[model samples]
Target: MKPEFENTPLVKAGKRFEIEIDGHFAFIDYREMGHQIALVHTETDPELAGTGAATAVVEKTLAYIEENGKKLLPFCPYVFAYIKKHPDWKRIVDERFEGYNKL
Candidate 1:
């Protein structure tokens, strides 16, 4: 059998963006590099596994970056994949690392 998951909004706090689900927090860590935001990592509570919390956090993070006129340096694989799946967000991706999209 398969499990079900839910999508929740993410909150930005300092250098990380987080989403709370099932009493646990799913978060993405990042670092600012000049005109870009380097997405360093993404993690979710085990209880939230298979849930869409990570995606929600990433979506919000991307929106925040774009809204603030910042580009994305998707060092995290999950963030890279999310951007690949949603090409509309590609506009915020750093062109210097365009090679990553091929991976």
Candidate 2:
């Protein structure tokens, strides 16, 4: 059975969306550049490895970006991979940066 995470709420703390797990944070760091939000990195505590914390944080960040009608620049490899696996998110990607997907 999958381990059930506590109701760890995702928080938009300044430039990142984060979730607290086992006293550490799992987060996706981002920066707003004009009309685009650049997803720069994702990090999870070593203790939270193998858990779904990273995925959860990414999902939440994507949803937040979508809801705000913002474009995306997925500069982070993990964010790029996640959006590649989930094509629906491609709609929000900035056209200039879409070339990154081909790399």
Candidate 3:
């Protein structure tokens, strides 16, 4: 089963992006520091929750980061939790975004 999201854009940069999907769009804002990608925000429509949209967006985002040979500062809680769930991705996670590490 899937949601009715199949033609939406994810991560637009000045009207362009490294990836795009359909139906529902995933919004992500970023800042570059040296060679790292600071993921400022990530969100999908509320109606798209639990429909694999989040994971798809995260995966696409990660792929972009990898292709660019950059690290990630996952500021978005959703991406942070996704990182936790996929520990293999820990290597790409910039320590600066680990705000809860000290707590």
lDDT of each: 0.80, 0.83, 0.66
How many backbone clashes does every candidate have?
Answer: 0, 0, 7
Alpha carbon lDDT at 80, candidate 2: 92
Which of 1 and 2 is the better model by lDDT? 2
Candidate 2, residues 1-103, lDDT tens digits: the string is: 1245445677889988898876888998889988899999999999888788888788878877898999989998998998888888899898889565563
In model 1, state the lDDT of residue 12.
Answer: 78
lDDT per residue for candidate 1 within 23-42, as digits (tens), equals 89889999998888999999
- TM-score rank order: 2, 1, 3
Which regions of candidate 3 deviate over 4 angstroms? Answer: 1-12, 15-22, 96-103
Q: How high is each candidate's TM-score?
A: 0.82, 0.85, 0.70
Compared with the true structure, model 2 gives a TM-score of 0.85
Candidate 1 versus the native: TM-score? 0.82
Instruction: Report the lDDT of model 1 for residue 89.
Output: 82
